[model samples]
Target chain A: MSLKSNVIGALILAGCASLYGCAGQHSEAALQQAGADFQKVKEDSNVLRIAPKDVIRAGESLARADRLSTYWGSGSDVVHYAYLSQRYSEIAREHTTQALNEERAAKLELERQRLQLALRESKLLSVQQQGKWLEEQIVALATTQTDRGLVMTLGDVLFDTGEAELKNSANRVVLKIVQFLQLNPKRVVRIEGYTDSTGGKQENLKLSRDRAQAVADVLMDLGIEDKRIQVEGYGDEYPVDANASERGRAQNRRVEIVFSDEKGQLGAAR
Target chain B: MAVLALAGCASDPAPNEQFRLTEQALEQAKAVGATADEVPEMKLAEGKFNRAKGNMADQSFKNARMRAEQAELDARLAEAKVLTQKSEEQVNVLNTRIVRLRKQLGDAQ
Candidate 1:
């Protein structure tokens, strides 16, 4: 064959070969895609992993959070986790409770025994999973900007008027917080307690420091790694706004959660 | 009938033979000098999975599962880029490579 003609033919062959290679890639890709789609359907169309136990666990988590909010006289993340974590938590509780009940009753028929075991195992997994989701939310909050820390005001809400020590009702709130800290710990949790500008700097700082310490101590008591928590007294510093009014000061009297600055850590990566 | 088929055959692309100019834009936003946003490719992968799901939602269990799996794959792949990636280079490479491949394919045709 002439050189030019031979080159043209070879190019055609090469083109077809590449196209065929692409076709192969496409084929496998298409199958993988199809399989993934099928899996989604199976997941969505299937029972969707609903468990009575999980629902119960989620309810308990929500109820506990609510009890905490009422006792603290402030915000509760109950509504939030209710929507997000309830399904799994409920499933966890139902299975765990049922398994315990059966064990107590000593009435496990052999046929039902395997199913009970499976439910209990799944319950444990679901609780573990729900805890993971709670961690993710905290991590997301920690990384979010300061104005949006999903933090509760530590002053009026957590303690009685002008009190640095936790209120009787505040104990539940502190315990809930301790649970959160224990489940989702990563870095130093700065409990920078603040107070209204109603007091002098010395008294305010002491109150702030005491309140922060009170909360920190609870977390420590709950077996949180003490080193992971840092307590500070911001003492009306960086007020949310001018302390010209009740609402303004109420907003200011809060404990802050400051994530370790990502700038320094990430910058050090280079 | 044969003549009509011949006329239909004269269409420029044979439809299958002609490929569109496919280009994707990658806006690599850094959180802190990290090229975390392998986001465009991730979106496209997600779209592919979505399309797969749409096309095969009623086909069979295996097919639907596969599509969902691809969605997770794409999601995970995008997430994987968040760590260990330099801010701009990886995205630039992907954007340029896809375009270059398209051009070469056209030239061949």
Candidate 2:
């Protein structure tokens, strides 16, 4: 063979050897990288516990890459297998992250629901306790719990025989009512005044109205809001006792206070 | 010659599909308030997705595929972050409501 032709042949052989060497180095590097990625995924605590299936797949892909690298040298198949192994490891990591996040989210959701239930229970207990307290206060005020809410009666002794001004003895009962109203700002009340059938109809009605207004004025002065009180007079109407006897007439001449329901709704006076 | 042959034969159309999927994922994350609550992760996802597109334009199919995969994962993480933050806000609002209700009960007592 000619010297120049021999030199050309040797150069081609060198180029082929270098190309093969480069391919082998590339495959070896890929395999090493894949092994490192798989080891990283296996070492992660969350991935090990929550992503077992993905970890196993990554392990299997890594094993396949190892076998392919040993059998195929620097072939494209070994590089592809190594790349697949790396992808599998990354997928395992992603799955682990998603699982951990979902677990944390679920825990938070459960905590929120628990807090909601606790708040609801506390609110219910508070309402029940308030209801019991209100009942006791009404009882202390000498009131009756009728369908028309709590009704308390003040006899003629609480006022002068012919005047609308409240007597000194009426202060205690009025104070009690003011305290109850203060305790329940949402509760409204109505003051109803009544009288026996002795005076002229107009004069009796005016006296009754003036007496109801006097009670309401005292309540307003004691810090009760004016909007929470209604005043009315029913002269000799809906009497609780017969007005023929003196005792019955005394009973008829009285003031009645009616408390509203929980919603602050008062019923019609009967 | 072998390098040319390998490039011509092994060029995958899969990177195109992966790029499209990553774009869709980013769009979905943004639609769900990811930009507001998950700004850092959303930005990372967008950056990686844009880089993937640049690689695709440059015909670096392998780099494009890897970047697209990473972008998809980041976008998914952003979506998860947005959901978690929204739930956290709901819990805060519920706590405030409970406090107000308790105050009303105290006032009544």
The TM-scores of all predictions, comma-separated, are 0.34, 0.52
Candidate 2 off by > 4 Å: A1-37, A43-129, A143-151, A154-190, A195-201, A210-232, A235-254, A258-270, B1-14, B36-44, B58-63, B77-109
Task: Give a tens-digit lDDT track for model 2, residues A141-244.
Answer: 75567787789888899888899999889998888788777767788999999999889888888888899999999999999999999999998787878989
lDDT of 1 at A209: 83
DockQ of each: 0.01, 0.17
Which is the leading candidate under lDDT? 2
Q: Per-residue CA lDDT of candidate 1, range A110-213, in tens?
A: 42454445556666676678777765655554433544334444446767667777667666656555666555454346677888899899999898888888
The global C-alpha lDDT for each of the candidates, from Candidate 1 onward, is 0.47, 0.73
Per-residue lDDT tens digits for candidate 1, residues B1-109, read 3453344334322111111111111122122222224455357545655554554444433333334433433343343344324323444454555555545444443
